[model samples]
Target: MSFKKRGPFVSLQLMSRWKNLVGLNVSIGGFVGKYPHCFEIFTHPFRRNLCCKITQKLKEVIVEEENVIRECEIDAVKRVKKLLLMSKNRVLRVHALRLIRKELGLPEDFRDSVLAKYSLDFKLVDLETLELVDDDDDDDDESLGVAKVEEWREVEYREKWLSEFEMNYAFPINLPTGFKIEKGFREELKNWQRVAYVKPYERKDMSRGVERFEKRVVAIIHELLSLTVEKMVEVERLAHFRKDLGIEVNVREVLLKHPWIFYVSTKGSTQTVFLREAYSKGCLIDPNPVYNVRRKMLELVLLKNRHSKELSRTGDETHEEKSDVVISSHDDWEGERDGDWVLPILMKSD
Candidate 1:
């Protein structure tokens, strides 16, 4: 939550305004208090108001995470280049790129650091759009036109010795746990997998049939998920790229229809789509630096409850010790009360 704040500390009053944004049922102070390990509550000396800030440990973790991302700038550039190559026009909207910037491991200032720095590879047409520059005149069309999935398809064909009809158009699918295989399900799945469609990076004529068009949309989504760090993204976030990616149908419905290739999780407030093959037991099969840093952040957040419990127990012990000392002092006074009466009377009389 502090990561989203613009300043070092956020006032309780200001944080209250973000209650709806953060989906908090209680006051911001109450929510922040729960996460003692992650956040520190303090009073501003000048303002004399309650404020919240991230703990020193959490701040260091955030800085370390940023440094890790900075170190991976080369890979981030490559991801952006591949994205441009995957687009229909070899151009993508700046807004769409911003939506998935973190997922793609690009820096916060990617506009200047990435697009402007690599001027020979990327042409900034305007403030809102960028295009890929053709660096080599001798480069053939086929070399620039391949989609990432084509490699997987080729391997499937060569290693499995599957027929061209089965391997060329098929996508790898991994069903989720407890997915019952109904009668004729395998036959139906096989038929759908064999249906041919235009690859995501390939050009298609307007006269293509509905089946082919929908299948191409599936390919586009698969490629997009593969590009992400987690191989998962919110369904709503993906909707922002619909126009730029040439997806016309309902994205949610499309994901639901192909459950084998994708998994729609409604576990939280947002519906997230995950590439089935990229994950095992709810974890990414191959984690990247950015993903590892994010997992560290999660661990820090989860430690808050345990930290709070420890503090509570220490406070209770301190209170008990004080009570025991007071009780002992009271007992000593009672025992000496009968003998001390003479000294008190003498002092009063004098």
Candidate 2:
């Protein structure tokens, strides 16, 4: 779960590698039996413990969502557009983007989908950097397709206020119900709430400036949240890539520092931070195609649970512990017989 990037499934055997994994008390086979939809237990053919793989249905759902992401590349490019425009050089490092690309719901080949199609709006420089450029070459270029970002923001602007005072609307904050506050917390909250606000896409020169560091932090975090479908994430998950997001080591303090722009939910044991502007009445108002596909995947997982429950009544177990298997001295799943299949194929070809 810690090392693997976003994938179709996670291997439960990783607990063996870490050894100190807490809270997981069940055997691998029993765990798969519990969530038949999300996981499938497979014999490694050599390794003693069973290996967990994603079901075929999960793979199909993943592939379908990949197509959906491809169709929604324009939305992704707009996100990239806003992100690059937020940066000082109108460019961002590709490797850093790689870390959060899936979270942003960008196609694996976003360069081909966004930059290649609209050559003037975006440019890939020296293969490692993505830069935002003017599309002055073709004034009528619309091949990149229309994105929901523009229309959605326009609607928000109109609905929130009349033409004159539209900018003054307060972004709502939602804290978890059980959160506790210390003495004088209200006075501190008021002091932190007064930071100057900057629109994400607009450029500001904060260098050699006072009180600008927190404002820039807000802008970067706001834009990062905007890129996510949920407009929120596990506090620890976001903390893992603070440097990649260009925030300071202790920058998560900024969330506690500014209560107006962020909301911390302590519903779970750990905290979940949310962009207060992104939600209304505890529900997200954004229309994200990526988010829709994720919901579809959840629905399929639920359906798989139902199907598994019915099938299990036939006395066919989902996973069974193999008592006779030996724990090999090898570290990886494969042992001395790893390359044995290649030799037979080579001999047959001769």
Candidate 3:
């Protein structure tokens, strides 16, 4: 039978409100009435177009609603159907079913579907009644219809697997022996593994762990390689400075071009002769970037000796000469001050 129509104005209004029906069940009376305003508007040809538009929009909403209901019911069905077959633990079964219903957007304070495939119900202590309920389920019977719930569940599981697989990015690594490839990368990997309980999962955990580990490791290794190269540059600079400054008194300069250098230079005369080399070496030392920035701050503390044999000859002569000069100068200066200088005496033994 043809449905009653509404006027163009009313039909347009209804069209505007069509999308709001999402998740709402279309009332039978509302559908049948077509409403007085809607009928008047929809009777005209132009108004009829508005009615059609509204109807199409409502159809889309209906389809989406159906899908949501189907999905939610499917979850409950899987739980209940499984419960029915295993045939025990009524409380758990009911709870699972209730959870599924809630997930499906069904009312929390409501009854199970009145139109459930089976019209059976059971009270506590009625084990026979429960058994009958299970037996009546068409889902378990092969001769009966295939449960759409099972099909939907498989689809859901497949979707989940694909989504998680796409995100998997960890790799297996043997710790202690395998150094990190990135800065702090090893620690991050360890934390992730621990959080995921990867060790207990073994192979499954390793597969993902290793993949993620590889990326982080590669990044770390690159940084370390760069740092090593930078360190070598510093060492070479030091070697060039030492050789140029002529501080090769003891240690051999065999490995002058080596990545690591051993050498020293004086800050005084040595610096002037080997200024360029010294400067280059200083630049390479890069105290700020090194592990211990203060390593270069220490200066030599030299101890002087008063009676060392090496300086004894010069020491005696200087001591005697300085004493004579001090005595003569003191007496002469005093006489001049008193204005009694009687021709500054030049004493000598003829």
Candidate 4:
């Protein structure tokens, strides 16, 4: 029986190798399951085309959305013209165009958002560049037809998890003038505030997550301006520590987002120190831990704020490392306001 099975194994090996040569990309598990079936059909060459035919069918299924999106683009171009004319200023025009394209079921690529950020630069002014016109170009030239617009549309149209500001006349309230509330600005605000300030909550409702969500996301962002003062206090602590130990790390590339405090060493390496733990432990001290941590924390709290670029960006790897680190807020799940998602902006300088 063993000798008789040798011929079958050889034929199976040949068929498996042939499948690989044809670039079928099927898994070995499926190939093993189909081995017995392949032997009976070996004499028939046409049966081998099954794998190729299946691969083509899968590709067609994936590409079917492309045609639907092409039609969506044709409709969007007509709508954008009307939207552009109705907008008040360059900033409002960008927001209006984004809303209209979203409403018309057209895509807004990341590039479109970026262009919207600097809409003043790309306006169709009374100029001499006729070559800039391209009929093939859709209004969302930034998406480059990878169907990002379609994906965004799907997210926008979902019954649940609708953007709170969508179709609502409510602008970002409690904001000073010269600032516009753009989509996804909350993400940037949270990151900036996290870097800029650190404060303890006396009451649970006054906690970062609860109070922040109840107010406009921008209000939480403006609160970060206080963080500059926090940084000065942190630097003073670092100065005291270095003076005691007589060692100088200089603490360059410092990113002081409290509760998950981060900084870079003299070697340009990253170090994250939790302020709560560091203060409690001997790692962060001002001659005494129990008596001084509270008084020292409050004494410099009222100082004027100043901006420092030292903690802005470290490097690409440090940013990537941040992603792998889990960052769950102490109060992530409690109910509050809707538009309160925060994310970080990758500044150019490390």
Best by lDDT: 1
Candidate 4 residue 182 C-alpha distance from true site, Å: 28
Q: Among these predicted structures, which one has the highest TM-score?
A: 1
Candidate 2, residue 91: how far the Cα is off, in Å: 1.5
Sliding window of 10 residues with minimal summed lDDT for model 4: 341-350
In candidate 4, stretches whose alpha carbon ends up further than 4 angstroms from where it belongs are 1-50, 55-63, 75-350
Misplaced by over 4 Å in model 3 are 1-55, 67-76, 79-110, 114-350
**Least lDDT summed over 10 consecutive residues: which range in candidate 1?**
341-350
lDDT string for model 1 (1-350, tens) is: 23223246655566566668645566666766666766665544544455556655677767777798789887777777777776777798988898778788777789998889989778999998989886657364455456657778889888989889887888988886799999999998898888788787666653278887888889889988888887887788888878767887899999999998998887635678888888777677889988777777777666656645443222112111111110111112222223211000000000
lDDT (tens digit, per residue) of candidate 3 on 17-71: 4434322244322332332211111232322222211222233433454455444
Winner on lDDT between 1 and 4 is 1
Residue pairs in candidate 4 whose N, alpha carbon or C atoms collide under 3 angstroms: 107-149, 187-343, 196-227, 197-227, 313-350
Candidate 3 or 1, higher TM-score: 1
RMSD of 1: 16.5
Misplaced by over 4 Å in model 1 are 1-7, 136-145, 308-350
Model 4 residue 106 lDDT score: 40
- Sort all candidates by TM-score, best to worst: 1, 2, 3, 4
Ranking according to lDDT, highest score first: 1, 2, 3, 4
TM-score of each: 0.80, 0.64, 0.20, 0.17
Residue 307's C-alpha lDDT in candidate 4? 20
lDDT of 4 at 215: 29
Candidate 2 global Cα RMSD? 9.9
How high is the CA lDDT of each candidate model? 0.70, 0.54, 0.27, 0.27
| Model 4 Cα lDDT, one tens digit per residue, 1-350 | 22222121222223344455433456432433332211111111222211111112222322343344344453444333222221122112233233223223344451243333334334433321101223334555443222212243355547546543441212112233354667987675554433311121111232244334322222211221112111112232333222222113343223232213332222222222222212322233332222222223222222112121122232221111111112122222221123121111111112
